[model samples]
Target: MDKQGANMTTNTRIYLRASTDQQNASRAEASLLEFANLHKLNVVHTFIENESGASLERPELFKLIAASKQGDILLCESTDRLTRLSNEAWDTLKQSINEKGIRLVMLDLPTSHINLSNAGDDVTTAIMKAINSMIIDIMAAMARKDYMQRRERAAQGMAKARAEGKLTGRKVNTVTNDKVIKLLKAGTHSWSEIVDLCGVSRAQVAKLAKVVKAEA
Candidate 1:
C-alpha cells in the first residue's frame, strides 16, 4: 500500500480462483477482500474463476486483462492460486501482466511488491524483489509439475480401461449430423474455417465428403 496514493483511490482488479467448481467460490474472495481492504485498494472489478488454472480459455481472466487499464493493480490472494498446472500458462499470465502495464500484487509475499510509481527506489530494492520472485517461480513450477504427473497417471488409467474394451467419454452431439454432412459436401471454406464452423477436422471432412460421393 502506497501511502501517497492512499487518499486518492486507484483502479484495482481483484482475481479470485478455486481449483474446481465443486469448491466454495467465496473462500478465495473472502480472504482476498481482506487483503484488498488492508491495502486500501479500490476494486473496480473482480474475476472469479472456478476451473483449473492451466486452461488457457479462462473467460473471466481474459475479460479482466482486456478491461484492465494502465497503472491498474491486479490483486490476488496468492501466486499459486493465480497459476498452476502449467509453466507455459504461468509464463503467459506473466506476459499479460507486463504487456498490459498492470502491476501484480500478491498478499502472501510482501517482497514481491512492485512499486511502479517509484523508479529511483526500485534499483535499491531490486535484489530483494528478484529473490522473492524466484521463490514464487520455483513454487509455481512444483505445482505445475505435480499437476502434469497427475494428468499422466489419469491418462494411463484411461488407456488401461480402453485395453479392457471399456467405452469412455461422452458421445459427440448427434444434432450436428445434417449440418456437418452439408458442410462436408459444400466445402464453403478452408479446413480451418470448417473446423471452426463444424467443430470437425480436415480428415473427418475429407472422409465424410468421400463417403457421400461414394453413396451418390
Candidate 2:
C-alpha cells in the first residue's frame, strides 16, 4: 500500500529539461508519471523545456516553482536535470525552493525517495533533510563540474581545428531550414513548439521567420 501523510498534501510539480532542442524534454514524462502514481502523489503539473540546466533563466522551471505552494513536492528525474548551474546560481535556486517550502524529490537519489513517503518523527525527518541536502549539494557540484569539463573539451577541439585550418563553421542544414520556413509560414505553431517539433534552436527559428517575412 502507498503511504500517505495524514496532515500534509502530496501535491507534486514535475520539472523536465533537455539541454538542446534536438533532445526531447518530455522523455522522462512517462516514467515520472508512473513514479508519481506508484507513490499516490497528486501530480499538479509537469513543466517541460529544452533549456540548458547550467543557466538559471529557464522560464518553465520558474513557472513550476511559482505554481507550487508550501509542502508541494518538486519532482525531477535527477539532480542533473534539476540543476547544472554554477554554485551561485544553484544557491539562488535552492533558496527559492526553500523559501517556497517545497520538497525536492529526485528519482535517482535514493535519499530523496523517502520524501515521497509519509513523514517520520521530527528528529528523523530533520536528519534525513540534512543528509539529503548534503548529497544534493554534492551532486549539483559534480554536475556543474561535468558541464565545465565538456565545455573546456569543446573549446580545445575548436582551437585545434582553428590551428589546423580546418575550422569551417557549422554548415547550414538547407533541409531543416526549409522545414522551419514552412512551419513559420503556416503560423500554427509557437516558437517553442517549432523548436521541439523541428529540432532546431529558437535562434534558428527566429532567423527563418525573418527570411519568410522578407520573402512575403
Q: Each candidate's lDDT (Cα)?
A: 0.68, 0.84
For model 2, residues 1-216, the per-residue Cα lDDT tens digits are: 223456546578889998776678899999999998888888867899877788776899999888887778999999999998899999999999999888889988989986776565598888988898999999999999998898799879978987898878787688988988888767789999999998999999998875554320
lDDT accuracy of residue 106 in candidate 1? 77
Highest lDDT: which candidate? 2
User: How would you encode candidate 1's per-residue C-alpha lDDT over 89-164 as one tens digit per residue?
Assistant: 7888878877987777777767656532334436557776567668878877876777677779987997798779
Residue 101, candidate 1: how far off, in angstroms?
1.8
Clashes of 2: 0
**TM-score winner among the candidates?**
2
Model 1: per-residue Cα lDDT at residue 77: 75
